[model samples]
Target: MRIRVDDLSGEATRSLIAHHLADMRATSPEESCHALDVDALREPAVTFWSAWDGDDLAGIAALKDLGAARGELKSMRVADAHRGRGVGRALLHHVMGAARARGLSTLWLETGTPPAFLAARRLYADEGFTECGPFGDYVNDPFSVFMMRLL
Candidate 1:
């Protein structure tokens, strides 16, 4: 699969991002859902990417610049057809590399705490992210798990 910076305009990318937002809302409370919509992802602070295998979109991920050499991982989603195929891991690494390229030294993320998010949490842990208190504009949230890694 190949990963590239996304403009958030393609139909497939838009559809996948909508589906990701819907899933986040369904699994987590509205107040705790931090997933950004397509418009939000287009903001200057966020850099979005889509992974593709030929004509198929394999996954999506984004890095939100938090300034001070920090970034927040956002909108990570592997297509249903690509689940368990290392798509997520690839996207994660792609975003991490992008962050490092931008001179970011730390990466942060907020994911769900429910069982639906277990695999995601495990993936982050396997990649060396550790649990941490909320950073940025986030406050302590029971439904959210915050993680961080120094690059």
Candidate 2:
């Protein structure tokens, strides 16, 4: 799979991002959702990437600079067809590599605390992330679980 910086306006990437946003909204209410939409992903402080196999979009991930050698992982998702195919791992490794390259010392994320998100939580834990308190604009919410990895 090829992982490359994404143009928010790219058709395939945009569609994948839209699907990710919709999925997040469906599983977690808007108030507790932390996934960014295309416009927010385009922010200067955030670096977004899309994974592809040939011309097919496989998945996407983004890292948001949080200062003090910290970063936030956002909008990580693998296409439904690509689920269980390691696309998510590849995207995650890519993001972590980018974060390290950018001199980040920690990477963090907020995911749903619902049964539907159990797999995601497990994935994060397997990748060396540990449960943590809320950071940034986030506040404790029953619907959210925070995780972090010290790089």
Candidate 3:
């Protein structure tokens, strides 16, 4: 598998991001879901990447600079066909490495609290992420689970 910075104009990357947003909306209804679409991923503070296995887009991940030596993980998703294949883990590791390279001392993320998100929670936990209070523009929302990791 190969993971690299995404241009957001590629069809495979766009489809992956669209699917991720749809899943977020389907899983969390109490809060307004606001995931970056392909166009939105092009923001200056955001860095997006796509993980590919040969020609297939296996997964994608993004990180947004939140200032003050902090960063937020956004739009992490593995293709349905790539689930359980370690694509998510690889993408996560890549993103964390990038964050560290950017001098971010802390990496944070918010995910849904649903059965569909259990694997994601477990992955974060295994990667040394601990539950944390809401950060950045986020507030305490019942539907969201916040996590943070020190780099």
Give stretches of model 1 more than 4 Å off.
none
Considering TM-score, where higher is better, how would the candidates rank from best to worst? 1, 2, 3
TM-score comparison, 1 vs 3, better candidate: 1
lDDT of 3 by residue, 59-121 (tens): 999999999999999999999999999999999999999999999999999988879889999
Higher-scoring candidate on lDDT, 1 or 2: 1
Estimate, for each residue in 14-114, the C-alpha lDDT of model 1 and write its tens digit: 99998999999999899999999998999999999999999999999999999999999999999899999999999999999999999999999999999
TM-score of each: 0.98, 0.97, 0.96
- Candidate 2 stretches with Cα past 4 Å from truth are none
Task: Tell me the number of clashing residue pairs for each predicted model.
Answer: 0, 0, 0
lDDT per residue (tens digit) for residues 1-151 in model 2: 9999988778888998888888888988889888898889999999999999989999999999999999999999989989999998899999999999999999999999989889889999999999999999999999999999999
Once model 1 is optimally superposed onto the true structure by TM-score, how far is the C-alpha of residue 147 displaced, in angstroms? 0.2
List all candidate RMSDs to the true structure: 0.6, 0.8, 1.1
Better of 1 and 2 by TM-score: 1
Clashing pairs in 2: none
Best by TM-score: 1
